[model samples]
Target: MASKANKELESWIKHLSGEDMPVFSGTVADVTESVNSEDSSASEVAQTILRDASLTSRLLKVANSFNYNPGGKKISTVSRAVMVLGFEQVGALTLTLALVDSLSEGVQRHKLTEEMAQSFHAAIQAQQLAKKMGCKSPEDIFVATLLSRLGNMAFWAFSGQKGTEVLNLIQSENLTEQEAELQVLGFRLRDLTVGLSKSWSLGELLDDFLSDHHGNDERHNIISIGQELAEAAKNGWDSEQVAIIFEQAAKKLGLSVDEVEELAHQNAKHAKEITRIYGVTDASKRIPQPNIDMGLIEEDVDEAKSDSTDEPRLTITEDTSTAVTSKYPEPDSNVQLTIMQEITSAIEEKPSINIILEMVLEGLHRGVGMDRALFAILSPDRRTLTCKYAIGEDNERLCKELRINLSNTNNIFHQVIDSKKAMHVPSDPKKLTGTLSRDTLTLLGPPAYLVMPVIVRSKVIGIFMADRNASGRDIEEKDFIAFQQFCQQANMGLTFLAM
Candidate 1:
């Protein structure tokens, strides 16, 4: 009964669905089911999310961000956030974060992070527009729009260069994204989303919203208009393209052209705040301001860069594991020095000792762009190097397996602790020595990795280990220097805690 395109899409869907798809939190699944049951409570949903410290921090950050707070009192606790934004909104946010966290691993994180920021921005804009149009429960609309974009996200994440070809074709030939996707990938991307939504048990509303039910379906038009404005603004706010998109959106939302343009500007500003909430700082910095000229936007971004710990280089994510290269020339020493200063300043805040270590791990994982990072503290008696914090896929497994026995004090980790030197071991047995436990080696997935000891008062207190793992980026000397410096700053924080 299916058309060739439909059949082909189903085949692709089957392939993707049958593959080990990323699972969101078990709590997300359970909480959603419990919400409809007889005995659901807001406290129950809040507790589930709080179980994961990272997710809890993320949710608190979003709840406290300017987008939601808007000069209101800051919401400090998860219970307060849950009370303010109803269970549905909190559940939706939890699902979104879980989805992002699950899918971001073992892929090009930088590229996924950009796409995720845009997707979140688009969903927010669409939801606001839908709410203005008298759609009840725009949160459902928000999650639906986001879920319907999974096919595009998956293509960009796992399809690699082939996906880029589809993207380039859309730009070069002026083809619709779906048209280019069909030509390049043998199926329309939306159809893949359709299949995935059904398979993933997302509500049928996603299908209806993504459909071509134009006249009676204001939701579809609102989402389309949001995407259009977002795409147009990416070109330049002052472009003729922006005027056209705004005109279309104005008609759909029953607003004047000026009103629609004002809405776009507001969304742009709010989107910037929301982007920061999710820790996508680079993407937040690059958000286009609808009223500002392109030149002024650059100046604003540069000014922001002055206050942050970033090196000003445009990064292009490629299919290759080592593909994220800066477009500009190599940065000078001042760049690293600036980031170290930022880290040191943050450490001076003297957050809880656990929070301090997590911040350092994030600095390595997100700032330094490592695929996997682990912070392993020495046991009280200094008998074992036990992974205490990890960021990446299979992190739980890594933590369990990366328990390095210090009984063999001649092992590589022990040697690094003794010498207080960082080591980057490339794919050489001579380089490996007794450094890697079999469990650690198995997790590394490649022949090489890097480890540096976290020393305090001239005594090794922990180990900082990171690698590209199956992503396959070879360790570079520059990256090692950055990691070593990160560990050094971490030591200062640890010492402060010790004192």
Candidate 2:
């Protein structure tokens, strides 16, 4: 019987790996490999995502949503998104979106919708529990819990006759879920989940939970509780099953029963919101809210839809819609102000120089509406300037290519370093005594760029450069002023560090 089950699982794996779910499988593999790599950087992950325009837009929208960015800091670029949301969180989001997009295509079924809804609810519940327990990586728990039932979701989503048979057996014969799956498909869906998780190299957390579902591991326990809660809540929060699960969770978490219940209820609502954000509107509607009446829930959803259409709650300014749809970013003064405030807060903490530079780059790229922004630091001997941080189009390549030799004072960058004055090339190219170096023009493309020197202790130490070369947008006077303001903030940060 075990051998037969194994054979059946292998067949299902082969079938799923074929053309039916190529995008989902490929995305899981690629994202997992990118994040798991030892040498992985945010740029690499950003590059992987920037390849798909649709994915990039969807990801940015979700990242900026109130649920993720409660502080209202606008995330304008994929690189910034990766920085704001940790690498693991971004990977989880990408995988979740891919899964939803894949399953949501073609025919829709009630069973598939329920399974997806449960997955979303379970993930959010597990993530909230992990946070309450002070787990270091709540995103891992969320992803693991979401994928715990991958086999069931995938099978029901794509299966035709076999899926109906399994459901009929469970309903008619009053058989257990596992018994029905085994009788109809010759293997349990749990076994299929294990196989898929292994084949895709999902993660160690998933592998650990699947291999030992009843282990002493705290994370595994949280995931188990989340799944149980999601299933029991279907009978409504006032049901005896929900009460039992709450008692169990209260004991496990060392929280009062009321606190556990409150946490679960809040997480359920968040699950619905996040599910809709992932573009699974139908599944989101099915996630049961604890105390809210169905009519009220529907009314709330309609209001949310209306609000999203009239004025997106995610962005800070009215021009955010332009920023989203246009090739060039529109200047958002509100985002700039928020980011500047964050920079001031970061400065007070006295963090590393890299932290300050990253925030500054984000400001220039997102807040100032530059197509590309870069910070280059002078070598100890002051002979060369190397790109230290960058954000925007082709940023990884820009980092590699942006190098300036200061020995040649005839170049535009060196002139800024020498004079300690900001230069806007498009405003008046002839005002500068020196010309742009062949390397600079070749790498940065054309004129219409801003360059500012970073002066500390009355000496130039680095430079902040920005341009709209990618989108070929004109750098207006206002943009130049914003760029200078951000550069001054960088100068202030560096001076504080020097002190």
lDDT of each: 0.66, 0.80
* TM-score, model 1 to reference: 0.53
Q: Which one wins on lDDT?
A: 2
How would you encode candidate 2's per-residue C-alpha lDDT over 1-499 as one tens digit per residue? 8888788889899888886677788888878887888976665676556545456668878888998889887776665677678788899888887777677643326667678889999999999999999998899899999999999888877777887798788889999989998898898898989999998788999999999856678999899999999999877778899999999999988899999999999999999988888777767887998876656646644655455335422221122443265655568897688778777876786866766777777778767888878889899999899987677777777788888777877877887888889988763566656777778678878788899998887888899899888887888899999999988998998899889
Best by TM-score: 2
**Residue pairs that clash (backbone atoms under 3 angstroms), model 2:** none
Candidate 1 residues lying further than 4 Å off, grouped into runs, are: 1-20, 25-31, 34-39, 70-77, 106-114, 164-180, 292-499
Per-residue lDDT of candidate 1, residues 373-433 (tens digit): 7788899887788887776545657766777777777677778777788888678787566
Give the clashing residue pairs of candidate 1, or none.
412-435
CA displacement after TM-score superposition, residue 94 of candidate 1 (Å)? 1.1
lDDT of 1 at 175: 95
Per-candidate TM equals 0.53, 0.71
